[model samples]
Target chain A: MRLSKLIAFAAALLLWSGAARAQQVSVIKFPELQKRLSRQNDTTYVVNFWATWCAPCVKELPAFDQLSTTYAGKKVKVLLVSMDYASQLDKKVKPFVLRRELKSEVVLLNETDPNTYLEKVDPKWSGALPFTMIWNGKKSKRATFEREFTPAELTAEIKKFLL
Target chain B: MKKLLSFFPALLALVLLSNFVDGPAGYQVGDKVTDFKLKNVDGKTVSLADNKAAKGYIVVFTCNTCPYAKAYESRIIELHQKYAPQGYPVVAINPNDPAVAPGDSFADMKARAASKKYPFPYLQDETQQVARTYGATRTPHLYVVTRRGSDFVVSYIGAIDDNSEDAKQVKTRYVEQAMTDILAGKPAATSSTKAIGCTIKWKKA
Candidate 1:
């Protein structure tokens, strides 16, 4: 009877910790994001640019979420970079990220002047959300779609790089 | 038949090569548009080359799904109602890729037109080439042109107005203000403003 109570207590602790970890969507500094990218060698980095208010961005988010889970055990990392306003980090961004139950690393991109960072992130990007970049240390493949994508379509792209 | 089928791959290759040779994407001011053939809601083809009454045209890259575009829809219609008879007709183009935004499909477009009763031509950019030609960055992005002698000159390229939200708080009616100047044969007071709206969904390069 004592062992059963101990097991239940441990389970509750595990669940609480998991929930806490999932809720933390902090404003990831640019340097930290770059460092994380550089540190992870031999792993494919799928970074998706998105915003909370953008309809298409919200629509296509599930596909990215599915992609992250499907490739979790592999040498793949999915980073969902929210470009929502810095002020919205708490009121909107974190709640949305949490509600979506995002499996990947979620970060509120800490940048103000889009003119400064748009090209820096990817020269081809026109500051469009739903933009995605696939990087594997050596080369970065960038794609900007002004529209939403199905999970299958997103999976196809991932498969190409995985191979 | 077998020989013809075997050459299909080569034929496809040639077509792809020619598409690249059409020169770079985008159009600039002062460019004369000789044609404006497009389908209407009732499935009727309309063209600018046939309209002799038009002194110029207002080509706007807009969509039904975008809130920004929807907000400006009434204003676009007003422009058409106010200026079309005076020789400036507004032409709204849906430049979004249907694959990305399925609601932008022709069927949805027809439904939207019927529902809203748009006064202007809401044409579909089948291959999105026309949108690329204009270098449109977002929905509700406007490009105004007027016929100068025999050519079309860009009068304005930017926002519908200064304010995206709160029409009551509008300070500058950039598009309308430009139209007024163009109608009077005077140079536009402000020729450009910051472009805003959902980004144009260009195909993956």
Candidate 2:
């Protein structure tokens, strides 16, 4: 009886630790993000810029999550870049991510002062939440959408890069 | 081959439709603004021409539903209190279609203004033409239109300041600086900026 109780507690600890580890969010600067986009690799990247406070951004996250799941084996990467202030990482961002159990990789964009960095992210972007961009370094082509995407619309956009 | 051919027409139609949706880039920094008469929350029509004694206007596109707009509400009020005497009164407008964003309905706007005790004219852009004409992309977007002879030319376009989340941590006051520059008989140093905010919920086509 004593052994079984100890083993159950150990298993619970492992599960708790694993779940906690999965909820950790990386905070990165714009240069670091730019570095990933500038890579000469063949992988296609679907990057979505969103925020927890943005109602539309939150509403559209599930579509991105679904895309990430369906394209798991493909040479595609789905990145959800959180525009929530770095100060809210512990308070809001992490809690929201954990609650959603988001399958896509999520990170906090640490850069502030949108005037200086907005154009750098993408000239087409007008600094709005729920923006999406798909790029392939090998293809040397990218498409930007400064609006929310439906699941079907997102899949169609990603399908072009897959071809 | 047949499947790929089917996609081309859809793609072409999308391109053409987007052109219609985007319309035009209404006002640039130096372009003179045409006056607009929008209904204020008090059930009275207000126009830029009505402010006869003012030198210019600080026009802000804001909505009650957006967090960014809510965060800047107090600062917006403070700006009107300070700048109205300086001959630059703030005119706040809600461009969101209430059907799309129920919280931005005229009744909700009236409640918000009354509860906040806003000292400025809070107007409703029922058709959203004013917002589109001004090329406003997000909530809390601002345009600094100063008097140039008899015309009101846009002097600055963009964010109210560098920081949108916290006003206390702000380093540069973009709108305040613009007002000071125009007041001192010079053009603004930084006439434009960019800040992230909720996308304007346009009425469905």
Candidate 3:
């Protein structure tokens, strides 16, 4: 009985460690972000650039959560790309993502320079956060809201792009 | 003659529209920066051309208001203190129109300078022409220029570091790293960074 209990405890430890490691958010490198943008088959990718410090971003996050749920099992993929500092991965980002129960895949951008990556993401981008981009199979359409956006406003944009 | 006249107008419009499409106002890396004489917190006139004798100048467009700008104030101060004597004096300019952002007015700017005990020139761009020339669209926007012979070439552009709140949490120090490489006459590995900040309040058309 003692041996069996020890084995069970060891298995539990292994499972816990595996879960913890998986919970670690990977900072998306520029090339990887590009690949992710391009490699999608039939799914539409909706990427929203946001930061934890941004009040508007925080406010609009729930709407994105709802959108992700609404599009469940569909070809639509919602990607919440946090432009927050990479150090916030464990300290703030992951916790926020977990607390909000974010359904979409979350990525904190790893690349440093925006001038190089901004144009790569979309030529029309002015490096504005709270920026939303929708990539259909053919072309990627982007909209930058200089101010905060509402759920309805975001949905309207998605509708326009998805069509 | 009619066809030529019509084609000329179309060509002219296309050229003008193309200029608008491309960012013509913003200063690019390695472009010469034109110096401007502006009033400082101490009510003294400071000009980049006058300080052209230095190896380079760190020109930052920051304001009294804006949380992101406030977060960077200490880092800016540290930057000025660390590299001012080393031929890279920081020249801070307030780019926001007072009518739009009252906190960025000269009076508030003076108060901010006094409260922060800023060591660099916290100048006021009253006409905001200098801000337009540099395409300064936000507070805490930075442009680092180096004197390449007689010309002032921009060495770096973007945020001071990755994190605005905690310096320790910064994954990338764009300005610091750029200045270090620039001081050594080497190319900056990364030249720019982008972050959302309060927009510069421009005068209404």
Candidate 4:
């Protein structure tokens, strides 16, 4: 039992050291997000809608995390917007971020009515989790995907918007 | 030519229609839906045709595993109890592929239905054909359809209420409102709504 305890302690230490700065999650409303999306800028924003409990959404985070590093210096910004209830921000969203050691900007969508936001954001979206939107506010050029992304697929999208 | 100019309106309509064609092409409001047979948790095949007396159906695509579905489970039961007697029955369908989401398997569905003593039919879309035809994208998605001759016309497609997380805090009951409108021999004032939910687990190719 003592040996197992020591190993567990070491494992916890390793996991703790692996995590970078804890992500500061900003809970924002749909109007605020719309304001951000409608900005006039050259920076390409890769925003992903995901939740803590969604299995496929969790599976695709590594891809988004990889892009955060691969384009760390560029004008590209990867934002992970948690579709998990805003009430779960401190309990689920923040802990999941720290545990996964996410290196991208994370935010919680603080809205109760999805009907108001879903259509405003993208008419094509069926309010499915793991939705992604790659856009540049400068040209009003945007591409929305309502599906999970593999690392390779994510990179290809990045090529279209970033490269 | 003047003939080409005359066809401009027709051509423009096609162009506008194509622009609105997004990924999923499911039933739209007022679209006639064919009856479908699916296996219920009671080891019986159930279909819309079975419920001849029902004026409308609140077809819900939900799963046992989804937290969103679980959150609204009790409210779903209440909906059936309230509206079923009013000739609108809740027909819950589990659309998640069992292989992808094990908790949504047939056995688990049966267990859940039995435990809850659901007052409605909890059917399984094992082939997922019905779900694909109806364009169900996520768990706890709803469609309220009213009988029109031999077919059912979609009256509403979307969320059950304004609040998904808290049933008590719900302000607008979309499905109930649709049922009320249909019963009143009028079209639903709020035809469609949307809510964030777990994506249906489709079988991988």
Candidate 5:
């Protein structure tokens, strides 16, 4: 019984670690992001730009997570794009995501030149953190917010396009 | 009655059009920036007019608590050291509301400036009017102003460089290039750039 309990504890530990490891962030360039943005799909995309060190960005992350859970199996997708330094992917970004147990899909934006990429994302964006973009390819509708959003506000924004 | 009803829709449309026509608030490149008198960390009031020998100013909106501001602190110090002698002194400003971000309070600003041994005047924009006027949305935002007669005209507005994380890997020094071009009586090759940074903590409305 003692041996069985120890084995169960070890198995649980391994599974927990595996779950944490699965949250590793993928580095993506602007072209890939553009392709994702331009893809013809019925799914509405909620792409949030954020960073580990940004206090407001971190504070609003749970809203994104809630959004992901609430919209699961629906036509809405939440993508949390980390603007943290690509060099700190392993040291900072990955660890923070794991620590927070972020449920939303997180990717580290690998593009260096903001002058070009900032316009690519949205012409009006001043490259500020905690910015969010919502778009529906099916309906040909899009919206962008350059500030933090509550879960309800995020839900309402995404719902507008999804409907 | 029918004619009056049709005019109501047009009146509503006019109101909406007026809101859009107002346009985005704050200054753009080539706009004239107003001088501000703000308290420095050294407990003295400083202004652009105080620097009598200065040809221009490198106005940087930075604060004490932001990680991006901390990362660029040394670089900002170096910018002051290099440019102050060249008649373009750096003027650092903390625009974040101390009430919203206590770490950015005046006391904290003094401590950080002292510890870093900052050569430039670290001023606090208590009213945050300067930041709003400059359209500075993030910490460590750079605005290069050139003096024309007595007034200052904004020449460049944006990031310090292409890379804020690694100085060694920086390919283009946007601020430096702009200042050098201005010094040589040439237009800045690159007037504006953007970088990811912490949003300024504004006071609660």
Candidate 6:
């Protein structure tokens, strides 16, 4: 009886963890992202745009994860905004995030038209993956990088805004 | 000291002027594109001028590695088959640097072309000069160039279709629409768009 009870507990634990993992991804519009950015008080947001298909983007994800963990206690928030197709949310994006056990907050940018939304994200973006934008709420200062970042580079960039 | 001060302003003006002369890099709609001699997969040199029968060129910057490129591969083949006889032949150029992206190397391109049985020429931009000139930022980037008198002018620039993931769900055929407009002697309604695909892998500086 005790063994059966323990087995049920283990199954429940597995199911609960699975639910938590699935809840990690949030489908966000550009406006919601803007609002979240504006609401931050003294936090420096390191928002990275990436996709599973983009080789460089995938290669550089570990750096973002390292930054998130290293600066957990700090005012820096690393939000990984996925640019994968909406149709790939379940089939690709979610599975990738869960498999990698990515610690950073992952969200899918749920916009259809890249033409209008690309400009809204950043006029200079040119619709490239692994794009990062660092902004400090207090200073109202922001910087954008269009290329992949190494862990040291990511940390240094975040430090600039934090300092 | 006076001469030096005056020289600084002239130097600054020259610097600004030089940057201006460089002039918003990349081809825009209506800009004339120079013919380039690039090596094709079939081990022969090909150029825009080589296709004398073509009225326009469907110049596409695509690589072997990109998932977006892979998804659009069959559609790209279909586009070539459908349009090649009608004047606009597809000229696919692998723009990614082989060193940076080994999967986009000449051998890989050749193998991919052979396996897919591409009817059109799949060329390699070894220096990526052609892609730089065209300002192709992503894989599967499309540019429709129409012959204008003695020059080839850019008529449309963007994606093949609205949906990159699934072909059946594609609502707007951007490339097809552009070609139709150009063939009918009308201006393309959507001349330029944000190209959504894998960023072209450039060699590290």
Number of clashing pairs per prediction, in order: 2, 0, 0, 0, 0, 0
Residues A17-39, candidate 5: write the lDDT tens digits: 75764487889999998887776
Give every collision pair in model 5.
none
Please list the residue runs of candidate 3 whose C-alpha ends up more than 4 Å from where it truly belongs after superposition: A1-36, A39-46, A55-126, A139-163, B1-12, B21-25, B98-102, B148-151, B162-165, B169-172, B184-198, B201-205
DockQ of each: 0.16, 0.64, 0.15, 0.63, 0.60, 0.45
Candidate 3 lDDT by residue in tens digits, A1-163: 9999999999999988756643556698888888887754566677777777655578888887687667666667777788776867888999988787676667888755565577677764555446676667654454444444688887787777566
**Residue A84 displacement in candidate 1 (angstroms):** 6.6
How would you class the docking of model 5?
Answer: medium
Candidate order (TM-score) = 4, 5, 2, 6, 3, 1
Candidate 6: which stretches are off by over 4 Å? Answer: A1-23, A37-41, B1-24
Q: Which run of 10 residues does model 1 chain B get worst, by summed lDDT?
A: B21-30
Which predicted model would earn the best DockQ? Answer: 2
Show model 1 residue runs off by greater than 4 Å: A1-49, A53-56, A59-95, A102-128, A131-163, B1-25, B97-99, B201-205
Per-model i-RMS: 5.0, 1.0, 3.9, 0.7, 1.1, 1.6
Per-residue lDDT of B145 in model 5 = 89
User: Model 5: per-residue lDDT, tens digit, B1-205?
Assistant: 9999999999999988965554345777789888899999989999898877889999999999888888889999999899889888899999999988889999999999999899999999998888988889889899988898889999888888887777888898889988889889787888888876788888878
Candidate 2 lDDT over residue span A84-115, tens digit each: 99999999999999999897778899976888
| Fraction of native A-B contacts kept, per candidate | 0.11, 0.76, 0.18, 0.82, 0.71, 0.51
- The Cα local distance difference test for each model comes to 0.73, 0.88, 0.77, 0.87, 0.86, 0.84
DockQ order, best first, reads 2, 4, 5, 6, 1, 3
| Best-to-worst ranking by lDDT | 2, 4, 5, 6, 3, 1
What TM-score does candidate 2 get on C-alpha atoms?
0.87
Clashing pairs in 4: none
Q: Model 2, stretches more than 4 Å misplaced?
A: A1-22, B1-23
Backbone clashes in model 3, listed as residue pairs: none
